[model samples]
Structures are given as structure tokens and as C-alpha cells.
Target: MPTEHDQPATHAEGTDAAPLAGKHPAPPCALVIFGAGGDLTKRLLMPALYNLSSDGLLDEGMQIVGVNHGARETSDFRDELTQSLRKFAADRASTFHTSQLNEKAWNWVVERTQYFAGEFESDDTFEGLKQLLSTIKTGNVVFYLAVTARFFKPIVEHLGRAGLLKEENGNFRRIVIEKPFGTDLASAKDLNAHILSYANEQQIYRIDHFLGKDTVQSILAVRFANALFEPMWRREYIDHVQITAAETIGVEGRGRFYEQTGAFRDMVPNHLFQLLGMIAMEPPNSFDAETVRDKKAEVFDAMKPLTAQDVVFGQYEKGPAGPGYREEPDVAPDSQTETYAAARVFIDNWRWAGVPFYLRTGKRLAARRTELSVQLKTVPFRLFRDTPVDRLTPNVLTLRIDPAHGTSFDFNVKVPGPVMEIGAVRSSFDYADFFAERANVGYETLLYDCMLGDETLFQRADSIETAWAAADPVLHPKDGPLPVHGYAAGSSGPAEADALLAADGRAWRPLVDTRKKED
Candidate 1:
């Protein structure tokens, strides 16, 4: 294992430089991953941490402590993690067809992994953690709660009693909590209040893994890096924005959890809202946590409060593969839970004054994909008389975040060789074509940010409230009998969804199916 170096050297490649170099360095800390025995830890968290450590972003004194409800010895747990990490590397290697694992660093990561088996609600078990902590001194601590929300308060309460929450003797403390933050507006507030009681707003980092994706983060770069976009990115030049997060898989084995939170809570409240804010927010004064968050909160707060007429909710009815939404396990027979939700929201702001944001997400849809499309308004007047109407399509900038990593811009152009036929041509920039290397995992960036006490991408309490405030009228029980529709599996959502936009003469973009090779 590498000994603690007073000043760790940066990676030789300039591309791998720390995101906020010199502004924030990796703090010497113990990253305690709660629910370490869970699938999330084995599949994502461990692999992410291992990768970060291998990249020289993590410190020599950095340690990872696992807290689990499982009954396994420390050695047995470590071995399990070691095997899982190797399996993760093998999976990654196979998927990307590359051997990028750092064997020496993998061994080091395995060596530093430790486990604590205890009940989160028990104060005594936490005292045991304090005893275990005595050996490591003068370092920061991050409690990563991958567990359920039911345990969120209990675990924090125990941590408070254990004297692990507050900074003392130059040791800083932080906690990372994963979503679904709440089921609704009221519950979200309650959860935020509970978490704030134990940790400061600065200390609590709410993780939304979507915010960490490379393409998603590229939105900032796409808009600001090029002068071509910034000048025309406004309501006057833009028609509307479409944000879609679709999935091909049905509830599958997540039936139980799916029955409780459907697509609205699962995707819209956090992920979709975050994407919208990123697209709509005014240029911040700086890229600091507060500045970016302040801009995002303003966007959410500016959203014209939804009304029933402005919202369209649909629960997936019986499809070719399985039963309808209400038929799912644990769902009430008459439950009005929405499996597919589409809404037209207005950001009553100067930049996006009249433009509508059409957002939608669903399960068992046409394809498995997530993307954001910024469609600019058509040309003020058409000069060509003989060209077909379809030829004059509006320009669009699409950011494909998952199932593929790329961006595309569609603009109108005259046909080649003596043809005045106006037609739209697409120019694309796919990451795969440029970088043969594997894209960094999303969780790694989020985990690294949380450990460094950076909340740039994490959702804040006020933003959460604003999101719910905007979404509540459409989502709440009192929204008054939402309409649910049945759509064929392996097909687009209900025709009603298409009609919802068709009335206004707009249509959803045809997304490529994941099972098929991209064209």
C-alpha cells in the first residue's frame, strides 16, 4: 500500500486534472458506505471509489468503512467486496473490451476496505464505530447512506450520539443520501427537516446520480463552450424543449418498489427537474455550489404552477408482457399512480418566457434511453416555393445521455446539385468516435464531489420544495381523477400522449431502439 504522502502528485495527463483543481483537493477522510452489503455498493459505489483511487484522486490515508445489517465477519466481508470488485472490473473490461484496471491499486483498495455489522437504530452499535475510529485521526468523514429512507433518520440519530457528525480537532464530517427523497411535497419537506436537524445544509449532500453523467454535465459545456449556441438560446429563437427519459424494461422484479412510487416520483421530481434547471438557468456568476444552485432554484421557482388541464397522467395499462400499473404487486387495485406522465410547463422567466418544456418519462416504452432536446424555432419565412413542407424542419440540438453518448444538431440546408429542395441535415459528434477510452462512471463523480464537500450537482432543500411546488398540482391526490391509458408493449406510449402534443402540431422525436444498432 502507498504510504501517506504529504502532497500527492497530480496525474501526468492534463485531461485527468481534478475538476476544481486547487479550489478543492481530496480531503483525508473515511468514506463510510451505509448498506455496503447491498447490490448498489457492490455494483457501483465500490467500483467508483476504486477507480477514483486508481486515478490518484483519493488520498493514501483515505479509508472505506462498510456498515451493513448482514452477519459477516470483517475478513469475509472484505473477501466478498474483493471478489465483487474483480467481477466489476471483468464486466467493465468485457463491455468496453479493455483492460484498464490498475491491479496494484485494486489490491490497495481491497486492503483498506473494512466492515461493521450492526443495526442502524441501535446506539450501542454506533459506540462500537467510535471505538473503531480511534485509530484514524485528523481526517474528514463522509457517511454514504445507500440504504432506504426509513433508516435515514435512525442512522443519523445514532451517528449524532456517536460523536461522528461534528467536526472536531480539524476533522470535517459530511453525509450523502440517495433518492427518492420523498413520495410527495409534504413528505419531502419532512425528510429534509429531519436530515437538517442532524446535519447542516452544507453537510448534507443529496445524491442524484443523473447529475453526474458525462453527457449531462456536458450541457454546461455545450451551451457555454461554443458561442454558436449562447446567442440563439432563448425563447425568441427557441420553440420548445423536450426532455425524455424512457425505459424498455417493465417493472420486472422491482414491482414492489415500483407499485409505490411510479414514474412521476421516480424520475420527474428529481432527475427531470435537474435536467430542466440545467437547460433553463441563467448563466451563473461562477460555478460554485451556491451560484449554480441559486440559478437552478430560480428556474424551478419560476415554473408556472401546473393545473389539471396542463397535465396528462397515464398509468401503463395491460400490455403484451404483463399486467397494468394497478395490477402490480403492492399497488392498490384502484390506485391512480401514473406510470407515464407528460406535462407542458412554462418557466415564467425573462430567458424562457413563453417557451413550454415538454417533459415525459415512462416504463416498457419504445426504447431504453434518456435525452434532452433543444429545438429552435423554424425560420421566420420560407423563401423556397416548390420544396415540401416537411423539408423545412426546425433546427434541434439533442444530448443523448444514456444507451449511447453523443450529441446531434439538425439544421436546414438546400439540397445538393441543381436541387433547391430545402431539407434538414444532421451533424453529430459521438464520443465513441473520438475517445476510444471508456467513459468514467457517473457515481464516481458524485461520490468524489460529496467527499470533497462540493454540492454543485446535488439538489438543495429550497430547490426540492420548488420542484414539488411546481409538480404538486398535477401529481397530488387532489388533482382529481387522472386519466390512465393502455399502450402496447414494445411501442410508444398511448396515442393520447401523441395527441397531447399533436393538438399543438408538435410531435415527440422518434428515438432509436436500444436493442438495435444505432443508425
Candidate 2:
């Protein structure tokens, strides 16, 4: 086993002299992951830790212990993680992949990394954890449940029974839970109550990785920091807002899980709603952790509960790209499980009282776009009625969340001509154009905040419940006649989704690449 170094850990290259300015290591603590052998652990967590190490944001005294159900020695676990990290580094598709491994940083992360294997349901597993912690000598611990939802309550109960959750001597004991918090509103409340029975709300971090994205976090800065936007962020000036999360790939082999949790249950209440909360929330008085979270909670509480008529559901059909969702492995031949979800909802608060917020997410769509577009009300076109222009273009501010990391605004500009003419153009900003940092897998910031006791980016119990409540009626509609329409594998979505907006005399913006020129 490797031992902690007395000297400070080495900073990564590119600087080659000192750590990044204004960045420091988080507090020293032990991180114990429950599903240590799962794909999430190998694919995201290890790379995130490696990135934190590369940035000198992981303390030298930090210890990483992975607890999963299996029989393996600590050394073997370390070796397995080493292989996984190297593989992730070499793969170009992975979010945190680099051309090569930074051995200096990788070694530092691995030195603190260890493993424990025991059944999550057995009392002896947590007891073994207690004994292991006694030897580790770290006063602070963060138990990360990366396992399936079924294992959550039992594992928490075991931790409470073992008394590992008790904090003293000015030390901290906390837990980080992955989402799919519940299937519906009632279950979400029940889950929250059950989890809180053992741990205080302060000690629980209900993580939503979507909040960790740079562009997602920048929503606040763009709205609050910029003097150009705050005054115009209301129903009077803005028309309906659209939030779209499309994917080009279908359920990629997790058919069993997807069958149980369709697109709405999978994306809406947590990921897509978080995006809505960011774009639609009232400005917080300050940027304090609780203050920002409270603002988000208010936005969630303001959502008008959905109904069957307000939402549209769809499943992907065969197209140019690949097989239909039903043909995917492990799925039922006649599955009613919807692969697409779209809804037009309203926020009942004063600031956003009559403006509709449109949300849609689905698999195997025309593009892999996750975007929020705020469309301003169109200007009067009486001046251009005779100038070869019928109506003025609606001014739109688009925040692209995935693949493309940036913001862009569209408006009309006068074209050069002898006669009066108008043309639409865009002004855009992309992170890659101005920033030199590598892209992260979205877990780095969430994990770092947990170690430092920050809840600004995490979800709270009330927020979670309200989000679930907003989506409940559509999730389990009392009306059985609600139909699931079909769109091709590479199309935008169902025609009904288009109809949702067409009914309002509006249209969806093209799902073309933001950085590239559109046809």
C-alpha cells in the first residue's frame, strides 16, 4: 500500500512552476464510493478525481476508498482503477479524456485511493467500513451512493446502524446521492423522508451533475452579472421560452433501465428542470449557497403542475441511422414506454406569470443539442410592411449546454442595398474560443463542493419534491387516452411536439450546430 507524502503534491504541467492562480486544494477528507465497480465509477468518478488532482484541487491528505459488493484486496482494486484511468485518458470520446495520462497527477490520486468490498445489505459490511476508517485516520468522510436506487435505503440504514454517520471532534460525515430520486411525487417525498430520517439535510448532497457544467453555472453570471439582461428577464418583454435536450443516440444497451424510466422520468424532473430553474429563477439577493438554492426552490415551487393535454410523448421509429427503440436489446416488442417527452408549462409566480416555458427531451433525435432559448416578443413591423420584409425576426438569446459550450444572440441587421432591406445575424460566444482549460465530465465540481461543504449546485429535498410534483400528472396520467406519437430515429421529434408550439403561432429554431453556419 502507498503512503501519504509529507511534502505537497506536485502540480501538473503547462504551469510547470506553481499551482493555478486562485485555486487551492479542497479540505482533506475520505471519499467512499458505494458502487465502486460500476460504469459510472470507472467512466466518470476516477477521471474526475484525476482532473482534480491535475488541477491541484485535491488535498495531499485526502483518501479515496471505494466500497462495492465483491471480494478483492486493496492492491487489486488499485490496479483495476489504474487500467480504467489510462483507458479513459486514451479514449477521445470521453469527456475528461486526455491524449495521455499525467503520471504526476494520476499517481497522487492513486496514492490516496483504496478499495473495500462487502455486501451493501449486510451489517458486517458497514462494520468492516468502521474498522477500515479507524485505521485511515481521516476525521471527515463522504459516502457516495453511485448504486441503483433500490440499494439506497438499505445502505443508508446500514451506515446509521454502524454509527459511521455520527460526527464529532469538529469532523464532518456526509453523503452524496445520485439522482432518479423517485419515480413520482409521492415516492419522491417518501424517499426524502426516509433518507432524512438518518442524515440531516445539511449532511446530504442530492447531486445533479447538470449543474456542474460551465455553461450551466454561467446562466447566473450572464443574467445577474451583466447589466444588459436583468431588466428584460420578464414576461412583459419575453415570449415563450424553449428548453430542448435532444440526443442522436438511442438507449445504447441500457434497455432494461430505460424501459422502467422513460425520457420524462429520466430527464425532466431533475436534469431538464434544473436548466429551467436556472433560466427562469428570480435573482437571488446574494450568491450564498443557501440563497441560490432557495431561489431555485422558489422556481420549482412556481411550476404549474402538468396535465395530459399539456404534454406530448413519443417513441422513435426506424430511420436512416439505426433500429427503433423497440428493437433495442432487452426491450419489449410492444413497449408503450415513451422515448420522447415534450411539454409546455407555465410558472405561476408574478415575474413569469403568463409566459409559457416549453420543455422537450428525447432519444435518437436529429441533433444532440441541449439548449435553452429565450425568445423576445417580435417588434412591430409596420415600418417594413412595404420594404420587402413581412415581419421582423424575434430576438433570441440561446444558451447551448452540450457539445457546444456557449451563448449566442440573434437579431436583425439592415442589409446593404439601395432599397430598404433586413437580414438576421447572430453574435456568439464560445468557451473554447476564449478559455484554454480541458472539458470536464461534470462530476469534478460537484465532488469538490461536497468536500468543501458547499450546497450551491446541489438540489434540496423541497426542490426535488416540487420538481417531481410538477411532472407527476404526465408521468402517471389519469387519462389513459394520451397517445405516444412516433418520430423517425433522426428526426427532431413527433409532429405533435411541433403542434404544441404551432398552436401558439411560433416555431422551433433549427437544431443545427451553433458554431457552424446553418443552411
Candidate 3:
């Protein structure tokens, strides 16, 4: 599946690529999207690829071989893709005049489209896949295993046996796997080892879709590009950082899936930790794969391990006619799985010695919003003694990731009245205004990167383990009043969630509208 959260901006050819150096470039091969019949394939991957193809970026002879368990003809799949493109890709298409995309693109896409259905482990299916790919004669191939985690090992082994492993003249062969890589640290290692047997570490792409968003990418630029922020980005000047990925929708149809993976595994390990790494990673020597990955891995390794008391595990209780986590079908009657998680983590390093990194994610919280709030410490002494310093709420920088795309800062400012009163003001830098363009597809940019064989935004193998290493201690089964708090279905979250920070003398900022209001 495509990465979940990041969005990319569309740009004219010459003006676009120079600034994104070492980040994204086009590729020259066919992409085989497995599980093409699934939701991820129909909704995201196909639409994204079609948009990229329309943009004049996809190379000649590029093909997409979609693998599904069903018996849909190539025409059926093409029609589905055409409709999705019309719906999702239309905005980008119009902006770039990519709508003039004609039948040649459709014909190329449909002609290359074919399906092979059989047991993933069965060798009988290999011959069909091999024959279909023979005509393409492409050097690079990307196999996206959109299937469940259970099928990863078997598919890798079978693909290796099919002689698709390492061709004598092929340029590159890679595989992209989605998250929930493992339930815990030990299982993650075993899974990695198993997959590594067939695909080398360099050839594997473990996707955390959150990393794909445009705002997420902009975070790096926000910090390093400008001199105003990066110098004060450590313990000495900054007070703390809070990364929150909150969802207003509950597990409606994903009840069965939610039974196995709780908020911790689903949100914290991959998304929240990735955000933290971006917030804390040292400046890379250069933007190459090793340089970026090495810097991220260091931040992960320095994460302070949490004891039982430092963490808060909460399973949302039934609120106002809503069903609790345990009430969902196929879930344990008294499952300890937490739907809401809040914790304080420390990075024991020179740059961020004692500053606590607060991260939280939960379903059925207030409104759906993902944001990072960085609070810089205030000045030592206030010259205006009588005035309430509430106006000078420490400088806060917010990076909003979803439902809207933008960045806002809360800084102290002078009052305008002649009375000579002082107050603070909030100013924002919206990505939309900066680009003067409508938002681009998050998946489309990520798909373009994957096709180009760029692993900069994608998660590396070591970073995955390091993230789970920090998360494992709290997620592991432990004893105590492992509290579960409940808030109304449409409410933000449990009351205790507020208490989590209230006791520490902090509170969550009010949910601000990330998107511009339309009349």
C-alpha cells in the first residue's frame, strides 16, 4: 500500500526538481502492484500511478502488473482505474493540464494490466507471472506486497524461486512492505530476518506512509533551511515537543483488524516515532541514503526507555452509546489492548538531554488532526512586572499534517493600543498560500519516489527496530491500574488524557482548523 499521511506539491518541470535534489526523481520501469483488487490498490496506488503517468514523468514502456485473487479482466481493472483517476486525480490534472491525458496512456495501462490468482505459496502461480512480465523486458521492477503481513515471507520465497530475484542485466529489483512489521521487538527481528533471506536490506522498502506527506517533508526544510529555528532546536532553548495524531473516527469496519493491533502498534511505533526522528535527527552530512538513514537511526537509539510509571496506557471505554474497544467483535472480552496511548520519552543526548518528548494517538478523539507542537522556553525575567505573562505563552511552532496542510507559530507580540499593554499573537505560514496552488496527492509523490528508487523518505530496516525498541517496554504486558479512560463518542478523548499533562503543568492546545474555511 502507499504511505498513509504525507502530501506532495505539484510543480512545473524545470522549477520543481532543482530544489528537491537528492529527494525525488523519475524511474524507468514497470511497477507490479500486488493485491490490486484491495482497497489500497483501487483507491490509492492505481490513482497515483495514473496521475504520475499523465504528468509526462513515467518512462516509455512503463507497465503496471496488478496481482489479485479475483478474476477481473484487464478491461474491468482499467475502468476502475479511470473512474478513480477522474475523482482523485482531476484536481492535479487540471492544475498541470494533465487532463489532456488521452487513450494512449489508458491503452498502455490496460494492455499491461493482467491478473494471476492462486495460493501465494503455491508454485503453480509463478509461471503465469513470469510469462506476463517477459514481454515488458524492463530493467527495474518494484513489487508492492499490499497483502497482509502473513504473506510477506511466502511471496518473497516464491518470487526468488521464480528467478525474478536477481537478473543478470536488470537495473534494480525492490520490494515495498507496509507496517505492523511485527507485533513486538522480537517478532520484528524474526520477520526482518526471514524477509532478508530473499531480499537484501537495500532492496527492501518498509513504508510508513506518514513520512510521505508534504508537510512532513517540509519539517526538515523548516528546521535546517532557515537559520531562525535550527540553532534554538535543542534542550538549551526549547522546552518540549508534542506530536499528536488524533482520529475522530472509530474502528467502524476495521473492528477485526483493530482486534490484533492497538493504537500503540498502529500509530505510535511507525508514525509518531518517525515524527520524533524528524524532530530530533541531527543534520545529515549530505542527503544521500546512508547519511539520512544514519542520522535518523541515531535519534532512535538515543530514545530513553520508559518504566511502568512514566507511561500511560488507556483503552477507551464506552462513551455515550458508543462501543468500547473490548466490545468490538473478535476482540478479547477483557483485552488489555489500548485504544489511546500517551507517553513521555526522553532522548539521552547532548542536544536534547532532559526535554521530554510527549506523543499521543487515539481513535474517536476530538476532530481529526495531526500536529507537532514545539514550545520554546520563555525569557528569564519579564520587564513588564504587573502584566500577566499569559500573553507571552512560550514560542510555539506547530506543523499541521492533515485535514489541512500548514504551519503556525505562537509568538509574543506588542499590543496595539495607546495604553501600552503587551500581548501575544498567533501567526501562521500556510503551505497552500506559499505554493499558491491546490494540494497535491500524498500517495502520488510517494509512488513517484518509490518508482525512482529513492529511499530517503522511506523507513530503513534499523530505524524500524529502533522505533519498536523504544515502544516495546510499555506495550509489553505489565501489571497495575493500567488505566482506560472514556470520552463521549464525538469527544476529544478520555478526561484523564488531559490529566496526563495537567499533572505535569501542561495542556493540549485547542484543535485549530488546519484548512481554510470555505464560504
Candidate 4:
């Protein structure tokens, strides 16, 4: 067992000759994963850490301690993780290349990884964990609670009681909390208050993996780094903003879990609202963590409270060979939980007083896609009204979040002939074309940021509460204004969703990959 004073010098302590030279490696830390044997641990968290290690971003003295209720040997844990990495590499072969996980990197990571079996609420388990942690000589610690919401409070309480949440000298303790922050506003507030009792605001990272995507983060650069777009980002020039997160598959096997967390709670408050903040927030004073988070929190605070009239819910019915939401294995036949959700949100601030922001997300939809589109108001083309051209389509700027991973702008272009016929042309920018593709599980950036103690991409407590407040009417309505509609499996969504935009004299942009089409 390595003592605190005798621990190996960290990657941060050595001369600047390693990979990413001149960049600060994370301080020596022990990452204690609460739900180590779960899918999230195998699928995302471990893969991300391996990639970071391959890139030499991890500290030399870093260690991974996985805790779970089931007892398993360290070698068994390593073998399972190895299999997961192999599967992840094959699954992401097209986008994130094969070089992400190699023999050398995998071996290096497994050597420092260990596992401990423990019940979340048991004092004996936590005491054993404390002894194991003391033997490791990690200066800083990160506690990642990847378990279900029910275990979050208990685990944190146990850690606090065990004195594992303490910060000594310059070393610190941070906790990464996975979401469904809470069911609704009041519950979310209660959860926040409880967590804050054990950790400071800066020490808590409420992660939303969507914000860690390369393109999602690029929203900032596109808005602030460029002078052309920011000037026109206001309500006067922009007609409305539409954010769509669609899925072709329903709850795979977690039907019981999905029943409690429908699309509104599952997608809207966390993932969709994170995108909303990126699109709607005012320019931050600086790019630092607190400054950026403050601006995003302000965006959530400015959102007008939603009413049942502003929202729509739907559930997918059984198609020819597909199972409906209730038909899934563990779900009840009369389940009223919504598998689809759509709403029109309004920010009360001056920059977007009248502009409506449309949000829609659903499972078993037409396509597996996530995108954000800004539709500019039509130009007052009185001069072209007399021409051969019919009504002009409004200009649109789209940020494709998944599958395509890029940005595209729709602009009118004249036909080559002398007729002056007008047609829409799409100009797109794909991330893969410009940068080298690397193995990324989306958690790489987020985990690295957490290790470096940067919370710029994470959600703040107030923001989470504010987002739930905005969606409360849709979740639990007093007047029963919104009806739960139905849509076919593999369809876009309910027709009522189209009516949501139609009522505003607008329509959703077609769900097509512009990269696959010609200009």
C-alpha cells in the first residue's frame, strides 16, 4: 500500500515532456465509481478514461476504484472492461477510429484499476473503502455516482459520514452526479439542497453529456468567435428556434425505468434545456466556468413559465412488427407515461421577447437524430415579388448534433439560367472533414473537464431547478389542457406536434441529413 508521502510523482509534477506538453495534466486523483458494474460504467465512463489515458491526459498517479454491491476480483473487472472497450471500438469504428484503444493503453489503464464490493448504505463497506483509499496516496478525489436516483442521497450521506467528502490543504473532493436531477421543481430543489450540504457548489458537477459534444461546444465558438452570426442572433432578425431530439428505438429493455421517466422528464429539462441554454444565452463576460454557467442560468431564469396549452405529449402505438411503449416486457398495459414530448418555449428577456423556441423529443420516431435549427424571418423581397420566383423560403442555420455532426445554412440561390428562378441551397460544415477523428464516447471531454475542475459544460443547481419549473405544467397539469396524442412507430411524431408549429404559421424543417444530399 502506497502512503500519502510515498505516492509516485504525478504527471503534473514532472518536466513538461509528455503528450500535450505545456498543458496541465489532471492532479493525482482517485476516481471512485459507485456503480462500477453497470452499463454506464462499461459503455461510457471506462472507455472515456481509457481514451484520456491513451492521449496522456491522465495523471501518472491516478487510480480508478470501482465500488458496487457484487463482489468481483480485480482481474475479473479488468476483463469485463476489456471486452467492453473492444465492443465500443467496433461500434464506433466509422466515426471514432481504431487507434483509440490499443494493447499498450489498455494494459496501462488496467494496472491502475481496482474494484471493491460494497453496499451503498453500509458502514462496513464504506469503512473498507476508506482504508483502501488511504492506501492509494491520491491527493484529490472524484466520486462519481452513476447509480439510480434513489441511491444518490444515501451514498453521499455515507461518504460524508465516512469523512470521504473532506478537502484538505490544496487537495479537493468533487462529486459527479448523473441526472434526472429530480422528478419536478420541488423535488429538484430538495435534491440540490441535500447535495450542497455535503459539497460546495464548485465541488459538484451536474453533468449533461450533450454539452460535451464537439459540435455542441462549438455553438459557443460559432456565436462568439464569429462577428457575422452574433449580430443577427436577436429576435428581430431570427424568426424562431427549433430543437429536435428524435429517436428511432424505444426503451430497449428498461421499460420499467422509462415508465417513471417519460420524454418530458427524460429529455426536456436536462438534455433539451442544455441545448436551449447554448442557443438562447447571452454572450458571457468570459469563457470561464462560473461566468458561462451564470449566463446559462440567466437564460433558464428568463424563460416564461409554460402552460399546458404550450405543450404536447404522445405515445407510440404498435406498428406491424414493433412493440409499443406498453407492450415492452416490464411496462404496464395501461401506462399513461408519454414517450414523446414537444413544447413551445418563450424567453422573457429583451433579446428574445417575441421569438418562440420550439422543442421536441421522442422515442420510436422517424429518424435517430438530434439537431438545432434557427429559422430567420423572411426578407421583405418586394423587388423579387414581381419576378418568376414564388414565395422565398426563410434562411435557416442548423446545428446537426448527431449522426451527421455538422452545421448547415439554407440560403436562396438563383438558377444558372437567365430565367432568375430561385431555389434553396445548403452550405454545410462537417466536423470530420476538418479534424482528425478520435475515439470519443462523449464523456471524454466531460470527464476530463471534471478532472481539471472546470464546470463550464456542467449544469448548475439553480439552472436545473429553473428548467424543471418551466416544464412542470407539461409534466403535471392542473387544468388537464394538453392531451396525450398517438403516433406510429418509426414516424416523426404526432400530428399535433406539427400543429404546434402550424398554429404559429411555421413548420418543422425536414428531418434529413444535409450531408447526404447535394446542394
Clashes of 2: 0
Per-residue C-alpha lDDT of model 4 across residues 1-519, encoded as one tens digit per residue: 011322333452222335465655566789999999999998889888877777777787889999999888999998988988887887777644773556666676778899899999899988999899889877688999999999988988888889988888667788999997899998999999998888888888898888878889988988999999999999889999999999888899988898888888899989999999999999988888888989999999999888877888999988742878888988988888899999899999989999999999999987888999999988765556344323776799999988788998989887787676777788888988898777777998898888777888888898999999988876678876367798888777889999989999888876654545755
Best by lDDT: 2
TM-score per model over all chains: 0.91, 0.95, 0.88, 0.94
What residue runs in model 4 are displaced by over 4 Å at the alpha carbon? 1-18, 385-390, 513-516
> Per-residue lDDT for 228 in model 2?
96
Name the candidate, 1 or 4, with the larger lDDT value.
4
Task: Judge candidate 3 against the unseen true structure and give its global Cα lDDT, from 0 to 1.
Answer: 0.74
For 1-519, candidate 3 gives per-residue lDDT tens digits of 222212232232422223243433355566877777787886667655555544555555566788877677777777877776565546556433455445554454556566666567778776677777777756667888888888888888888888776745536778988877888889889889988888788788888778877789888999889998888999999888999888877777787788678787888878998999999999987777668889999999999876666666666667753777677777788777777878788999999998988888888766788999999887777677566555466889999888667988887766786665666667877766767552245576777777666678888778888888887777664665366655565566667767777877777766544545333
Clashes of each: 0, 0, 7, 1
Assess candidate 1 and give its TM-score to the true structure. Answer: 0.91
CA displacement after TM-score superposition, residue 251 of candidate 4 (Å): 1.0
Please give the TM-score that candidate 4 achieves against the real structure: 0.94
- Order by lDDT, highest first: 2, 4, 1, 3
Judged by whole-model lDDT over C-alpha atoms, candidate 1 comes out at 0.79
C-alpha lDDT of all candidate models, in order: 0.79, 0.85, 0.74, 0.84
Better of 3 and 4 by TM-score: 4
